[model samples]
Target: MRIGIRPARVVALLVLVIVIPLSVTSVAGRFMGDRVYLLNSTPCRVVVMEQHDGHEANPGETVLIKSGFVDRTPTMMVFSGSAFWFGGLHFTTDTLQVRDQADIAIPPSWLSSSIMGKELTYELTADGQLLVKGPTMQPSMPQPKGLPLKARATPDSKQCRRG
Candidate 1:
C-alpha cells in the first residue's frame, strides 16, 4: 500500500497558518493603544514640544510644563528650547500618556542642555532606555537676578483699571 498527499491541501493549510497569526496581530495592535506614560518627579519646570496632528501635519509648538508634586499630569515631552525629549517612541497608531508620579526622577542634566535653536529629537524607550539623535551642546541660560517680574505699587486705584 502507498499513501500520497494532495498539493492543493498542503498549500491551503500553509496559507491558513501564515494568515491567521498576522491578522490577529494587526487587529491586536490597533486595539491595544500602545500607550506609554511619562511621570515627572523633579521640582523644576520643564518645557516640551508636542506634535499636533489634525487634518494635516502642523509644526509642533513649545509647551510649558510645571513640576508634578504628587498631583498633576506628567509631561510627555520636554522641550530644551531647540531640541525636545519625548517619553516614548511608537507608530502613529500608538498612544502617548503623560502622568505625574512622585517616584520617577529624571536626571537634571537631561533637562539642562539646549540644542542651539536647532531641532533635535530624543526618545525614552518603554524598557527605560534613553536615545538621542545628537549630542546636546548648548547650556541652559543663567537664572535672572531677583524676581523674574518686578511689580510696582499703583499710585492711584483708578490707574489699575486703565486698559
Candidate 2:
C-alpha cells in the first residue's frame, strides 16, 4: 500500500479531535459546577458571644461564630453591660468569670459536644449576661469591673434586650 501525506487533512483531523473534546468538557464543567452538591456530611457545632460595657448595645448589631473540628470541645463567652453569656464544654476547674461592667449575650442556638468528658462553664452578671475578657483563644487577664450579675437571670435574653 502506498500512502500520501496531506498537511491540511492532518491538521483538520487534529483540530476536530481536540476541539470536540475541549468543547464538551467545558460545557460539562459549566453545567456540573452550577449544581450544588454536598462534599461531606460531617456535623459541625458553633457558639457565639457578644459583650458590651455599661454602654448599651445598639439595635441591629449581631455577633456570630463558626467552628469546625473532628473531635474537640469549644467554649465561648459574651459580656454585655454588667452581664455575660457562656456555652460549650468546659472543665470544672476552669474559671467562669468576667468583668462586672460588661454585658453578655449567648444565642440559644449555641451547642456543646455531647461527649461525656465535655463540660461547659459559664459566669454571668445579675442580668444574665456574659462577661468576657481578653482574647477569644487565650484571655489572660480579667475584664474591667462592672456590676456583678447572675448567669441564671437572663439565660435566654437577646442582646437587644440588655438595657
Candidate 3:
C-alpha cells in the first residue's frame, strides 16, 4: 500500500502551526508591555513647592507613585503676571502662556524629569519614600505703558456742521 499527502491539507496544517503560535505570543506580549518593573521599587510620595510673599510655602499638593518606574510629561498653562502701574490708568492684565515640548521624560520618579522646559529633581530614599522638587518661580516681565492719544479738532467737522 502507498500513501500520498494532499497539498491543501499541508497548507492548512502550516497555517495552523504558524498563526496559532503568533497569536499566543502577541497576546502574551501585550500583557508584558502593560507592566513596568523598576529596580528595588516601592510606593513613594511627591511634593511640589510654591512661593508666597518672598517665602516658600507648601502647596499641600502631593502625588503618590511607584518609585523608579514612572513615565510622564507635562504641558504647562500659566498666567503671565504682567502689570504696568501708572497714574489713573492702571494697566494690569493676565496673559495666557502655554509651552509645549514634544520631548517628554519617562516616569515621575526616574531621578531627573523635565516638564514644560523646566528640569525637576526627584530623590528616592531607602525607606520606600520619594521627594520631588519643582522649578523656582521667575520674575515677572515689564508690562506695556498706556499712552494718551491727543485728539485734534478737524476742519471738515467744523464745515460739515454749517451744512
Query: What is the C-alpha lDDT profile of model 1 across 14-62, one tens digit per residue?
Result: 8899988878765553234222222322222224333442111112222
TM-score (all chains, Cα) for each model: 0.23, 0.20, 0.22
Question: Which of the numbered candidates is closest to the native, going by highest lDDT?
Answer: 2
RMSD of 2: 17.8
lDDT (C-alpha, whole model) for all candidates: 0.30, 0.32, 0.26
Answer with 1 or 2, whichever has the higher TM-score: 1
**lDDT, residue 25, model 1:** 62
> Of the pair 2 and 3, which is ahead by lDDT?
2
Query: What are the runs in model 1 whose C-alpha is more than 4 Å off?
Result: 1-5, 36-163
lDDT of 2: 0.32
Better of 1 and 3 by TM-score: 1
Which pairs clash inside model 3? 70-107, 71-107
Order of the predicted models by lDDT, top scorer first: 2, 1, 3
lDDT of 3 at 25: 62
RMSD of each: 18.4, 17.8, 23.4
